[model samples]
Target chain A: MIPYSKEVLQHFNKPHNYGKMKNPDGVGEVGNIVCGDLMRLYIKVAKDKKGQEIIKDIKFETYGCLAAIASSSMLTDLVKGKTISEALDFDRKEIVEKLGGLPPVKIHCSVLAGDALIEAIHDYFNKNNKLIPEKLKLRHQQLQKEKQAIEERYKKDKAV
Target chain B: MKKVYLDYAATTPLDSEIKKAMLPYMDKEFGNASSLHSFGRMAKEAIEKARQQVAVFLNCRPDEIIFCGSATEADNLAILGAVKIAQKKGLKPHIITTAIEHSAVLEPFGQLEKEGVEVSYLSVGPEGIVRVGDIEKVLKPNTVLVSVMYANNEIGTIQPIAEIGTLLKKQSQKIIFHTDAVQAANYLGCDVQKLQVDLLTLSGHKIYGPKGAGVLFIRKGIAIEPMIYGGHQENGYRSGTENVAGVVGLGEAVGQIQKTKNEIQNIKRLRDELISNILQNISKTSLNGSREQRLPNNANISFAGAEGESILMALDQEGIAVSTGSACASGSLEPSHVLMALGLSPEKAHGSVRFTLGKYTTEQEIAYVLKVLPKVIERLRGISPVK
Candidate 1:
């Protein structure tokens, strides 16, 4: 068994912001069984006093290992009530760091959480017909390509 | 937290009596068995006694038992060693084995395939049981060996080893029949005549004996080309200074099994209760493999919405040791090959967990597991993206 950090085990044992969010402005599902990490994020968006969009609430549903679940739960805690732009600045490293550390092989799980966030924000922008940010678009495009390769790998190995 | 070990299929703890039997060989009597003096004679005498005990346990000739470092080595000796004799005789070898064999058997066959020897991997049905007809379908006149496990390591599904053994005997006097009986030796009380196998493998650590000692029973009159060469130990079949203490431990363990053979009923009762309650208390749960034809100590289950790794981690937190077929748990993206060969979807395989009982398992431990398991499964299901 992998030696998980105390923080990681705590979050995994009782993850926060883990469930469905009703009437959410956006939802994101990323990763797949092929990579051994499948996760979905739900977010509700609202306007702040300054008329800039902020995340009112967030939640996640993940089917994965300790690191994946811990990363998902930590991602939600990191970005729950932040402005959309601040949440957009979320890096995969922060989750790994906030959890103290993760195994090198499991760093990709944190990336999944970050990718799911980008996907959720993109969905929110598209749904509201808001001007999409350039950086979010590029990240979304990369995520799509990565997901396509993963799906192909799944198809290739299904014969086993 | 109270720790409960339910992963006996992985390996068993050393038995106290076996430890007592092995102590002197490790210390005072540690002389090399091949030396030319009283020290050597004493060590050699101890090893011979261990051999006779194992022979009695398996009902084979004492000289037929060869002690190796581990069950994996024993399996390699039985499979690869037997085929080398056929190679020397100038016969093209065709080997038949099930797709679910341990890597010890499979990897040797794989290497043989690369060397242009024909090999057939027999598939098992959803019950994880191999049919004798499948072996019959693939047997060729040149087939050298047919290796099947007496019971599966993962799901604890018992295979029809005796029937398959009988089939190979009736088909061709030339075909060598072998079974990896590492997991079956304790509860099954393997009698060589009853199993009718020309070659068989057993392990020490899997039956409450020390690790680093294993047995390969090769019937008399069957020839095997040795893999390792040196010191002329183990009839030149295996060539290392004997693992005296480990072999002594193994022999003691085997002797204890013969005495406690009837205790299997208690393990079966505990296992049945565990399986029944897990299914009844937890929703969307079902057992894997054929219930009636399964190992008495095994109860592999799949909880529909709970991912195996998460459940395993949760159970681990509560100090319960078990096993899972999930990809993440193994640090590999592939689910268990044995479960896949049983025709389970990858998702179902990911949800599967193995809980094996042993003689040490108590009713109180079972109750505690039943109490903790449902809550953990329910918690994981709540977080699962599936449902």
Candidate 2:
């Protein structure tokens, strides 16, 4: 069994803002079913006092190990009140540090959380017909490639 | 909190009676069986007695049972050795095995395939059973052997070994039939003649015996090449000094099973209750293998949206020990191949859990597990994103 930190277990047992939001402004779903880790992130955006678009609320649902669930829960807590640009700058490393660091095998869970946030931001931009930045587009393409690789590997393994 | 162990299919706790039977061999009676001394005779006699004990359980000749390091070695010897013997007769050896075989059998067949052997892997149906007709369709004049497991380790689905055995007997061509009966030895009667098997494999630790002991039953008049080339122990079939203490424990364990056969019904009743409760109380949960054809002590179920590893960890925290069909526990990210071969979706396969009862499993332990399992499943399902 993975030696999960007490904080990670706490978040996993009582995750905040779990479940789906009705008609959310932005949604991001990532990870593969074959890899046994999938996360769907939802965000409701609103204008703050300065007329800057900020994440008014966030929720996540994860199908994976303890670390994956905990990472998703922590990611929602970190980005709830932050501006869209500020949330985009939120690093997965900070999530890991806050969770007292995940096992090496489970570091991918933190990365998944980071990727879900980026995809949700992209969804927000796409909803408003705003141009997606080149860097975010590149990262999305890379995540797509990783997903294809995992699917191909799963197919080959099942064939064997 | 009291601990409840339900992972008997993985391995069982060594019975105290078996330990007692092994103690003398590990201490005072430490003479090599091959030596020409009085001590050697005593040691040799004890080895023969254990062999006879196993033979009585298997209903085979004492000389036919060859003790090896493990069931893995026995499986390797049966496949590689039989194929080598067929190769010596100027025939291209063809082998057939089921997809659900343990890695011990599959790896040897894989090595043989690399060495230019014709090998065919038969697929099992959703019931986790290989149709005898499928085996018949693949058999050829040069097919040297057919190896299938008697029971699956993950799902505990018992195969129709006797039916397959009977079909092979009707074939005009001589095709040696082998079954890895390691999982069936404890609860099932393994009469070689009645099963019509040419070779069979049994493991010690799986039957509440000591580890490092295994048996490969080779019928008389069958010629096979030896994989190990050293001292001509066990009539040159398996080479090395025997594991005396382990063999004694294996014999005692088999003897105990034979003596206590009546207790199996009690275990079956507990297993039935556990399965019915989990399926009835939990939503979106289903059993994996054939209900009627499965072992009496086995219950393999899958929760729709929960991940198996997380459920396992939660149960571990609650002092209930069980095993998951997910390969992640063994440091692999893939789900169970057995569950996959049974046509389960990857999500369902990844969420499977196996609970195998034992001779000592009681009603109270079953009730405790039933009480705790639903809460764990609900907890994991709440966190799952698959819905």
Q: Who wins the DockQ comparison?
A: 1
Give me the displacement of residue B102 in model 2, in angstroms: 1.6
lDDT string, candidate 1, A49-156, tens digits: 999889989999998888899999999999988999999987779999999999977888898899999999999999989899898999889988988997887777
| Per-residue lDDT of B230 in model 2 | 90
Q: Which stretches of candidate 2 lie over 4 Å from their true place?
A: A1-8, A46-56, A77-83, A93-104, A148-160
Residue-level lDDT tens digits of model 2 in B1-387: 889999999889999888988999998999888888988887888889889998998899999999999999999999999999998998998899988889999999999899889999999889998899999899998988999999998898999899999999999988899999998887787999999999999999999998999999999998889999998999899989888888888888777777657878998999999999999999999999899888889999999999887888888888898999764565567778788889898899889999999988989999999999999988778767776
DockQ of each two-chain model: 0.64, 0.60
Clashing pairs in 2: A62-B385, A63-B385
lDDT of 2 by residue, A36-141 (tens): 8899999999999999999999999899887888999999998899998898888889999999988888888899999999888889888989888888888878
In model 1, pairs of residues that clash are none
CAPRI rating of model 1: medium
